[model samples]
Target: MNLPLHPLHLKEGGHVVDFHGFALPVRFSSILEESAAVRERSGLFDISHMGHFEIRGSDVVQAVNRLISSDLERVPSNKALYGHILTEEGGVVDDIMAYRFGEERVDLIVNASNRDIDRKWIEDRLPSGVRLADHSDGHVGMALQGPMSPRVIGKILPSLVDMGRREARTLSWKGGQFLVSRTGYTGEDGWELFGPSSEGFTLYSEILESGKAAGILLPAGLGARDLLRLEAGYPLYGQELTLDVTPFDARLDFAVSRSKGAFVGKEAILDASGKPIRHEGHPALTGFFVEGRGIPRTDCPIENGSGAVVGKVTSGGYSPRVGGGFGLGFVDPAFDREFRSGVSGKVRIHGQALPISFRPWPFVTGGILRAASV
Candidate 1:
């Protein structure tokens, strides 16, 4: 696997790990330490391995709008949208964040592992007068996330302080152009920056220095990023979502706009909604809190009180901020109803049954999200 680290990452002593064919930093400090830093202050992340695509031409908006579940008509120019690209059968191809640059140009940020498939998917379905171009190789992306993100980022890009969530702007600095978006995977107020790949290190260093001067920034890695997002009740691709799961099944109906007229998966989505399919033989996906010491891993079986197999865990771990282990996974919706209503169940980890209970997500509350709005 090719290791693509931002120059500043090397300088900071990033410990790189192979993640789905891309070498990414597991942590600069320890995962727990980095996680604490973000909760208390801010953190920087190098996310250049993610993919980017440009869609342009006369009918770009109309063409692009038909491709995703979000109501793109409502997404104003210079604003970003969080939604999914669905297959013809209504299953999710990938969940992406699309930024509308203008009437004729739009930018898409997709998951790293799905880059090739997503590019080809958009290219094959492009309407007349619309063209799709892959620019992931030419751009490097990074995120500044946490409660203090806006304050630190404002030092470099003051205009960012007033930008609303999902807003974006193209700014110039040192003879280079960057498309900065007030968006991030973490449930914190932050921004995602995009610019030339060759200058990734220089830009990263400058941001790091600026953050250090502010005394609220820290270098975070994938570990902290995952936990923060999960705590926010955000769903991750390949875990809470998959090509086999429709947007409706994942409780993402908000993304599907029936008034948008015809999309690729319109028929399937409409039909499925009228008579949703229930996973009779499958376990339902739900949130659970572990009562004992055990970290649930992917494919960990979940059993009901009668010891019947109900579902399997998708993502799980001890949340440093939450002080307990929690997980998200699919189980039979029948079991889900029972569990949610107080029926007890157990998560099978290492061949041992660990007691579990259904818990509401966004386990932590009253943070920067409230303050940022104020």
Candidate 2:
């Protein structure tokens, strides 16, 4: 479970932690410092623990499209599309990114923790003309993120700079071809690159050295990455998304292709969206900022002006950019509008109810210079 970049991270003073059975860095210097570095400049992350799969066959697009919520045929060649693999009941199995190379080939990047689950699910469903290849163990994934990412990445791989957002290309680096995508999880203008495991050390070292020459890049870890994604209002698999949560409940309607004919869970999803089952008060995801001294945490109760519990925090943390604690949580559909417009919302942190304000997310964009364009 040791990553290809494990030694490099250790040499860079990373604080190692066990994450989903993989040994990964929790922080390189400090979480706060790393967060700031990404916002102000750039940060490099080792994301090799993620699963990579390749589907190749004459009917690859049609075969893969039947399993996910998004329509692969609609995606332009060499572009990536984000969607979820749903269960029959319309609950999320996993959120994934699918990169289409052509009608005959497609690539997928799935969460590290769900590698086996996703593989098994996909393998069992693939039709006769298509085949799936698991390259998770043989590949290394790396990300260069933030405002200065373009500059830093350009120093190492100049060809990647011209790619538009969500664009993917198989380009040569040191005489070897690898996949590079103008995509990232940190809500920054960045690129996620994948190459052979054997080239991991060299690739990481070269990028690190290039970043150092610019004096604007830092080695970041999971803590900062989590915070960045949270600020961006992106959902995490185990947090905002789960087997029990549907895309409708998570407010990810955009990831679902309602027009894309019969996909897995299509009927259930349409039923859910059309006539939502109001379990747990019929929750809907929303963002909030704590207005008092206390920081919010997961499971904290959110109450209305009349003191009725309307929602519960799913992810919460302090962000200096926000000037205090911020969170994303699920609330009753009836109160979604009131909470979104900053009316009558309060979150109980510890034993006290703290006033809160609501806002749309990608909460802070000042540091996302390059991302702004995309």
Candidate 3:
């Protein structure tokens, strides 16, 4: 389960751990240290474990649009779109990023854990004239993120320096074309690089060398990646998203094409939107800032002032930007409504009802976002 860049990580002193069947780095130095480097400078991550599927043929756009919640028809060439593949019951099969090459080709990046299932799902639903090919094993994925990412990449791939957000381009490298997308999960100015697995070592080494020349690049791992995404208030597949959770529950309605025609789970999503379906009540994913000293963890109960259990934590951890323990959880719709209106609540951490406050999304935004920093 080693990635093509596995040797490079070990050489950089990365501590390896089993993550979704792949032996990936958990940390190179320290989570806090690596995360700080990414925010201030640059960090590179080995994301080759993710699934890569190439879908081609004249019906590529129409075929994928029928399977995902987002409308691929609206996406222009050389752009990337994020969407979810759902079941008929509105359960999420997987969250994916689709890179459109043109009208005839689209590349899908799916979760590592759900790779097999997602491939089968797409394969079974695709009609004639659409061809699906699994290139996961033959591809290498890396993400270079932070403020200095553009500078580092500019040194190696100068053509991508000016790529706009959510844009993708395939440039010739070593007689082969590699895909580079201006997208990332860390809520920073970043780019994702994907190319032949055989070239992974060379590509990673070149980026590392460029980063070292800039005097700022760090080799980050899953630990830093998790914390960074948490700080950005972004959701992980198995954590904030799951088969039991709908796009509505995770507050990812923007990914759904509401104006589009029929799609899988469209009816179910419409029915579940704003409806109380869960046991305690329908839930909405919300961010929390723990005022107390303890860090929040998964399954911890989120309670109201009246001592009623309203929700449970899905993903929780310490964030340097938040300056304290912060988490994302699904709370009862009623409780979420109250909190959005300025009512504070409590999260029970090991029997202690610590004071908790609502924190707006994209908890830390600056580098790429030109708006007011939160």
Model 2: residues with Cα > 4 Å off, grouped in runs: 175-177, 271-281, 366-374
Which candidate, 1 or 3, has the higher lDDT?
Answer: 3
- Candidate 2 lDDT over 1-374, as tens digits, reads 78888888889999999999999999999889998898889999999999999899998898899999888999999999999999988888999999999779999999998999999999999998789988888578898888898899888777778889889987777765577899998888888988887776688889888897779999999999998888877899988998877888998877888778778878876754544333454478888888878788889998998889998999988999878999988888788887766585899987899988886676777644222111
Predictions: Cα RMSD each: 3.0, 2.8, 2.5
* Tens-place lDDT digits, model 1, residues 1-374: 44345456667888878777877888998877777777778899888888888789988987888888887777899999888898887778998998897789888999987899999888888987888878777577889888898788778778779988889877776666777898887777788988776565567777789998878998888888887777766788898888877776766666677566667777766754444444334334588889889998878998999788888888887886667888887888888898989988999999999999987666555444331110
For lDDT, the strongest prediction is 3
Please report, in order, the local distance difference test score of every candidate based on alpha carbons.
0.79, 0.85, 0.87
Please give the lDDT score at residue 253 for candidate 2: 77
lDDT of residue 172 for candidate 2: 74
How many Å off is the CA of 246 in candidate 3?
1.5
> Per-prediction TM-score, please?
0.93, 0.93, 0.94
State the lDDT at 153 in candidate 3. 91
What residue pairs clash in candidate 3, if any at all? none
How many clashing residue pairs appear in each of the predictions shown?
10, 0, 0
